[model samples]
Every structure is written in C-alpha cells, then in structure tokens.
Target: MLIRDLPYADPGVPDVRSGRHFLLWLGRRQLRGQAKSLAWGTLHMASVASIPIAVGLAVQAVVDRSGGGLALAGALLALLGLGATVGDTMLHRTAVTNWITAAARVQQLLARRTAELGATLTQRVAAGEVVAVSTGDIEKIGWCVESVSRFSAALVVALSVCVGLVVYEPELGLLVAAGLLLLIAVVLPLLPRATRRADLQREKAGRATELAADTVAGLRVLRGIGGEELFLRRYRSASQEVRQAAVRTARMWALIEAVQVALPGLLLIAVVWHGTGLAMDGRITVGELTTVYGAVTFLLFPLRLVQEFAMAYSFSRPSAARAARVLGLRRSGDGAGVGDGAGGGEARSLENPAEGDLHDPAGGLLAPAGRLTAVVCGDPDEAGRLAARLGGHDPSAEEDPAEEEGERPDARERALPSVLLGGVPLDAVPLEKARAAVLVQDKDPVLLSGTLRELLDVPGSGRVSANEALAAAQCADVLDALAQGTPGLNGDPLEARITERGRSLSGGQRQRLALARSLVTDPPVLVLDEPTSAVDSHTEARIAGALRRVRAGRTTVVLASSPLLLDCADQVVLLQDGRVTAAGTHRGLLRDDPHYRAVVTRETDDELAEGTTHA
Candidate 1:
C-alpha cells in the first residue's frame, strides 16, 4: 500500500475485538508495504554496520604499509556509502508511505462510521473525543505503524552483527552479548510504568479538549446569561489538570531515555576495556580491536531504534483502543432481526423503491401519504422522542437488555415500537433510503458555515427551488439582516457568508435558514420538531401558513403545541401518556377536548388580557 493508493483500496472490515487486535489488523492490511520497508531498512542498517569494518581495514592497511589493502578498503568504503545512501532514501520513502496509508485507512473508517451513526454519534461519544481521535490519535497510530518495520530491521541487524563478533573474537563477543542482555533486562521493566503515565496524560488531555469545545460552542449563550466567567474558570482548571498529567508522563519517558543512553555508553566502555586486553594478549589484532570497539559504538543506533519503537507503541495502544471503541459502536437495531426489510436483504437491491406513508404504531399515530399532519404532545420530551422515531431513530434499540430493564419507564420505554413506512418497519430500510424518504428537522437544527446558496444546494434538487423554500421559510428579514452587514454582497442573501454554526446570525435567523435548507431537500416525508419555536408569534403564524401551502401534497409531521401551527394542520393528533388520545381538526379539538385546549393554549392570562387591551 502506497500513499497514492490509500484510504486503502479496500478498508476491509476491521477486527474490533480490542485495540491490540485493531493494530494487528492494520499491519495485515499493509503487509506488502511493511515488507518493502523492512527490506530497505535492513539494507540501510547493514551498510551502517559495514562502515566500522571498512574504517578498521583502512587503519590496519596504513599501519602495515600495504597500498593494495588501502586501495581495496577505499573502494569498499565508496560502495558501502552508495548503498547506505540508496537504502536510507528508500527506507524513508517506504516508512512515510506506511504512515500515510495507515492514517488514511483509519480516517476512512471513522468517516464511514460517522455517516452511519449521524446525529446519534455525539450521543454515544463526545464530539471532542471524536475530534481528538481524528487528529492526534491518528498521528500516533501511524507513527507506531511506521516504526514497526524499522524496529524489525534493527533487531535483525543487531543479531547479525553480534553473531559476526562472536565468530571474530569469542571472549570479547561473550562480554558484549552479556552487556546487551543486561541493557534489555533493565529497560523492559520500566515500560509498563511509562505506558500507564501516557494513558493518564491522554485521558486528561481529552477531558480538557472536550471542555474547550463545549465552552466555545456555547460562548454566545454564556455571554448572554453572564456565565462566561464560570465556564472560563472551569476550562482553566481542566487545562491545568492536563498540564500536570503531561508533566508526569514526560518525566517517566525521560527516565526511559536516560536508561537507553546510559546503558549503551556502559556497553561501549566494557567492549573497549575488554578489547584492549585481547589485543595485548595477541589473541586479536589492532584492526580486530578497532572493529570490536566500532561495532559496539554502532550498536547504539539500533538500541535507540528499539527505545523509539517502544515509546511509539505505548502511545499508540490507547489511541487504537479509542478508535476501536468508535468503530465497534453500532446503531440500535442495526443488523438485528427485529426490523429486517428495506434496509437489508433483497429489498436493499432495489434501485428505485416506491415511497409510502409513515406510521408510528407505538404512538398510535398515522401520517398518511401526501397529507399535512400535526402532533401535539403534553410532554416536550415525549414529543421529541416521537419525532426521532418518525425518522427511524430509537435510542433504546441499541441499549443493553439488563440496563434497559433497570431504567425507570419513560414515554419511549413504555411504548418501544418501531416506526413503519407503508407497513414496513422504518428501521428495516437502508439508512440512505430512509434518509432520502424522510427528512427530520430537530428543534435545534445545525446550520453549517457556507454561503446561503451553498447551504441550500442539497442532493436531489428537482422538487423544490431555493427561492421557493426561502420564501416559504419567511427568510426575507433574514436576508435583509445579512445583506445590511456586507455592502459588496449586492443585497443578495444567497451570496452572503454565514459564520460557523451560523453564529453570526440571530437565533431566529438561524432557525429559519435551517428550515429553508430542509425544505429545499423536499423529501417525501418531513418531520419537524418545533421548527418555528425561536420566532415571534406573528412570524410563527406566517411560517405556519407558508408551510401548509408549500407542503400541500406531501407528508409533513410537525411536532409542536403552538396554536398557529397546529391550527394550520389538516389533522391534529393530541399525544398524551405516550399515545394519541385525541385526533381531529384543531378547531374541533379546541372546542370539544378541554385537556387538548389547555395544552395548546398555554399563554399566561396577563398576556391574553394584554392582547385584548391592545385590541
């Protein structure tokens, strides 16, 4: 696998058993690249090891006054230099390829998982954690992957050099071997402590990152409520905790580095001391003593390689574990035998499946095809849960059975039934198909940063035009507000840029823009939860009227208790105790059902009296 071929030609299903298993899976996926890296790394290290022998030969030639040997040594040195250059270049190239390819594979997996989970992703994992995994964690994992080949090559070169030394001078070779073994024994015991510290540091850093993200996301709200100082203090505390943890982790790693350096220096001293005795005893020549000293000095390079690989692996293990946790998350009822219809098997093979009515059996509500239906729930939470179900989302579907039994009964738990489309369970439909068939706009919809034109440009664009949707959403004031701030925009809202999360716009402006974006998609079924809650009563009335007119022949389910929106619906279903207790025209329900009237007419008496006084 090369960088160009990445994101993996096929990022095959991962073995998400554990973090260690996931790392192994990555290695298997790029076996060929790893092999190439190993081969080049071996060549590089071998040439590096050969340099000491060349230098020793040159020295001996000069001492013996042999011109032919000197020339031969020079020629050999040149060849080794050329080999080292080629090997080093290719080694670097292959290592980088491995790093990039591994990171790309992980990125692709994460992107796919995010798409599959959609809005529920943040519910299961922190947004900051996801961000951390995609950025820092990915780099650590790639670093480990890149180091593996180099480490293996270093081990091979180290062993080959040791064997050659043993054959050249048995007495000095035994001493060198014992010193190497002692170094390994001393360093190996310290690794677990270092790994533990690294884990602690990473945990603290993730919490700090999460706090920072949350603070930034709600900065506007914090300023509005005079709570900026409180959040700022909280973030500062988190940052300090992260700093302390990082310092502790750094200290442990520094100890390991000290050992790596100090142990090798000791080994080099032992070889030099012992080699001098062998040369004096006439058991080894001067050239042989030089070679022994040079080889031990060169051995430090491989020892450092081993230390680097250990450090990289320690950091990457936790990162891989985090990635695996995300990859292992499956949506509720995903691949379960519960709702197995359009989302699986032969039904998924269909190119253009027909559209149908949406039904919520548990709620005892039916949103007929091509009709505007409104749902009014006494409890806002119940209403939100019902809206999510209408879009084929059930949080309980993926919950553990034991934990599900332990929770107190709520609206969702009381009636845990799947929503259906045309008698087929909605969850049974493929997510893409279900998303295309039904568009659900939550109470707090997100508006991505982009030009108005770009925001409105959605997939499948024939059913509704951007202008029509904007008008229906009553975005004229929003457009005017945005245009007033920028003169070069030519008073065209479509050309104006919205800040991240539409932060530059007011709450009402952002809400309307989100509605317009949703309306532009023109899905067969549109389920909206409090779509006009942020607007004033008059503006809400306009939106209610416009929505009725624009969605005349499409299935629209609006979960709101607002009288204006409810009155505009052809049918109003009053949801109470997690079931549809009353269903009729809004006026009919107001006249006959006291409970329904009370729920919809929630305005204070002072407000009603004030309105009458104005009239």
Candidate 2:
C-alpha cells in the first residue's frame, strides 16, 4: 500500500489476538513493499561488502607490479562504488515507503474502530491512550516494520562476509566469528531490561497524556470551581513522573549503545593484533592481513543494524499491544443479530413500524410513541445508564457471563433486559438499523469545529432543513452571538466558524447549537439527556416549547428533572432508585407525588424569581 491510497481504502481485518500476532499481520499485509525493500537492501549491502575485497585485490596487484591486474581492480572498485550509490538511494526510498504505508494501515484501523464505537469508545478506553496509540505507537510500529527487511539483508551480508574471510584466512575469520557471537550473547540479556524500562516509560507517558486531556476538557469547569491550581499541580506531577521514567529508559538504552560500541572496537583490535602476529610469522601476507582488518571493520555496520532492529522491536511491542487492545474492541452485537421488521432487511427507511413505544423492561418505564415523555431519575448516573439502554446500548447485555461470575446472580439476570421498540427487542436488530431508529443526545453534546452549515450536515435524509432545525432550537440569539464575534460573517451565522468544542461560544450557545445539529438529523426517536441544562430558565422554557412543536408527531424522550422541560412534556415519569414511582402530567405529579415535587422543585423559589427577573 502507498501513502496516497490511504484514508479511503479498507485497512482489512486485523489479527488482534496478541501484539506479536498483530505485528506479523501487518508485515503480511505489506508483502510487496517488504519485498522491494529487501531486494534494495541486499544490493546495497552486497556493494558495501565488495569494496574491501576489491581493495585487497588492488593492494596485491600493486605489490606484484601487475599493471593489468591493477587496472581490473580499479574498474571493479569504481563499479562497486556506483552500485552502492544506486542501491543506497533505492533502499532508502523503499524503506521510507514501507514505514509510511505501515503507519497508514494502523491509522486506518484505529479510525475505523473509533467510528464503530463512537461516543462509547472513551467510556472503554482512555482518551490519552488513544492519542498515544494513534501518534507515538504507530511510529514505533512502523519503525519495526521498516527495519525488518534491512535487518535481514544485513544478516545475510554479515554471514557471507564471515564465510569469505574464513576461506581467505581461517584463524582470523574464526576469531572474528567468535567475537560476533560474544557480542550477541552479552547484548541479548540486556534487551529484556531495556524492554522493561520502555514499558514503564510508556505507561507513565499514557497516564500523563490522559491527565492532560482530562484537564483540558474540563478547563472551564476547573476555573469555575477555583480548582485549576489543584489540577495544574496534579498534571505537573504527572509530567515529572513521565520525565523520570523517560530518563531511566534512556539510561538503559545508553548502556546498550556503550556495549555496542565498546565490544565492536575490542573485536576489531583483537582481529588486527592476531593478523599482525600471523603476518610476522609469514603465515599470512600483508595483503591478506589488510583484507581481514577491513572485513572486520566493515562488519560493524551490519552488527549495528542488528542492534537497531532489536531496539525497534522492543519499542514497538508495547505500542502494538495498545493498538491491538483498541482494534479488538467489537461493538456489543455488531453484525451478529437480525434486524427488526422496521428499517431492517431490504427496507432502508428509518421510519418506525406501527408507531411503536420504547419499553425499558428493567426500569419498567415506557415512552409512548408520538408524544413528549420526560423521565426524572434521582441518580444522574443511573439515569444516563437507563437512557443508553433506551437507545439500544445496554452495557450489561454485552458482558460475558462466564467472565463476570463475581456479579450477583440477580443483577446478572437483570442486566440483559432488552429495551424493546414496537414489541421487538432492540438488541435483536442490527446495530446500524437500531441506531437509525433512535438518536440519543447526551447531557454534554460535543460541537465539532466547523461552520454552522457543516455542523448541521448530519447523516440522514434531508427531511429537516438547517434553517428549520435552527429555528426549532431557538438559535436566533446564538447566530447573533456568532455574528457579533466573527467579522465578514455579516450576520450569516451559517458561514461563521465555531472554535473547537464551541469553546469560543457561551455554554447556552453551545447547547443550542448541539440541539440544532441533533434536530437536523430528524430521527424517528430522539432521546435527549439534559439538553437545556446550560441555558437560562427563560431560554430553557423557549427551547422546551420549540422542541415540542418541532417533534410534534415523533417519539421524544427527555431524561431531565428541569421544571420548564418537564412542564412541556405531555407525560412525566418520576423514577426513584431506577424504578418508575409515578406517571402523570407535570401538574398532577407535583400535587400527588411529594418525592417527584421535591426532585423537580429543587430549584429554589429565589432561583425562580431570579429567572423571572432575567427574562
């Protein structure tokens, strides 16, 4: 694979059984590039090996005073030089190609996994680990991939040189071979130490990265709570830990480098010293002695390649393991189930079948179709979990019973309760089909950085226009805010650029924009969790009314306790300890259910008065 073919091509299914298996799979995928790299690398090293032999022959010829032989030797040397230049250039090109293509393939796999898991990925994996895998991990994996062919070529050249030297002079050749073996034996044990240090460093770095990402994501909240210094100190400590680990890892590597350099130098000196003794005794000629010295010196290059290959592999193993962890994550039941009668099979429409109600068997809460229903749960976390289940995402349903034996039997039994739509189990349907039928907007919706038009250009039929969605979201003030901030927008809010996560905009503005984006998708079932939490009471009231009108005939489930939003729902269900305690109109619930009233009326009379004054 080439770099240009990337991002669009399928990255193929990976064998993610283990990190080693994944690395091997990557190598198999890029056989063609690997082959080219190997061929060029062999040629390059062969040219290098020929140089010493040519020089040895030239010295012999000059000593014998043979002009013709000298001329032949010079010609051979020139040819070797030319071949080395060409081979070196092509080798570099192919090696780089291998590196780039391998990295691209890994990146594509990561991107696909991220898309498949969507918002749930962060729930399963750390944001920093993902970032590290996509960045540093990939580079290390590519380095190992690119080093393989070169290492193979170097090994072959080194072996051939050893054989040739033995044929020319046995004693010197044997000594050199023994020295090479000694070097390998000494370095082999140190590799495990280096690898351990690398793993430690990577672990520290991943933690630091996770902390930084969390700190940045919650920077606004930290500032509001006057906790920036606390987090800053925590991050600083994490950074220091990373630095210390890196230093320890580097020290180990430096020791290995010292061994690589010192051992090779000692070997060279031993070969030369032995060769000099042989020459003095007239057992070997000066020309032959020169040949042995030059061969051993040249052998250092290939020995270094061996060292590099080992280092690259050590660094890449942990990275590949991280990558494998991500790639191994499959959606709860992706491609494993049949679809529901509605929007499944040959049917492509996203419309609900028979205007079905959404039923949560575990919570015993039912959201009737074609109406605005509100659910208020005492525990926000439980509410979010229930909301996810309503949207066909039950984490318990995806767990393995055999692995989770420690869980209570009753809890395990209750865990797999499937949310049904139109009387059909949601999990029985294919994931894409189920997702198309229901849209869940979380409490904190992310607004991607883009123009308003781009942000609202979500997948689905264009049933709702951007303007209509924006109006339904009560985004006139949001557009006005954008127009005021951005020059050349000229009051064209759709053309204005939003900063990353809408940080440049106010909290209410971001919330409204997110709501507009969700509205544009026009799904049959819209599940909103605290959609108006950031807005003022008056704006929340306006949004509640507008949302009802916009989703008049569709099934809309709002998981919130806000009085304004609940008052707008056609039916309000109060949930206490994950079970429905009361179901009625908002006014009826307030009058009859004291628990419901206390939960909904937590916003004090003073806050209500302030809201009224602001309005």
Residue-level lDDT of model 2, residues 1-615, one tens digit each, is 666776636779987766788999999988998899888988889998889878888898888898998899899999999988998999899899899989988998998888766666675678888998999999999999999999999999999999988887899989998998998898899989999888888878878888988889999889999999999999999999999988998898899889989998999999888888998999987778887888988898998898899889988988888788777665444434354344363233224442888888877899998899999987888877777777766655433323221221322343556787887676556777777888888777888887888998899657788999899888998888777767898656799888899998888788889899888888888999889888889888888999999888889999998989999999999988878889999999888666787678875567656755654
Candidate 2: residue 12 lDDT (0-100): 91
Task: Please give, for residues 258-363, the per-residue lDDT of candidate 1 as tens digits.
Answer: 9888988888887888778878888788888888888888899998999889889989988887787777655433534423453453354323223466788887
| Model 1 local distance difference test score | 0.82
TM-score of each: 0.88, 0.88
lDDT at residue 221 of model 1 (Cα atoms)? 96
How much does each candidate deviate from the true structure in C-alpha RMSD?
A: 5.5, 5.6
Model 1, residue 403: C-alpha shift (Å):
14
**CA displacement after TM-score superposition, residue 264 of candidate 2 (Å):** 1.3
Question: In model 1, which runs have C-alpha deviations exceeding 4 angstroms?
Answer: 6-9, 333-355, 361-365, 377-385, 397-418, 573-615
Which 10 residues in a row give candidate 1 its minimum summed lDDT?
A: 401-410
lDDT of 2 at 3: 64
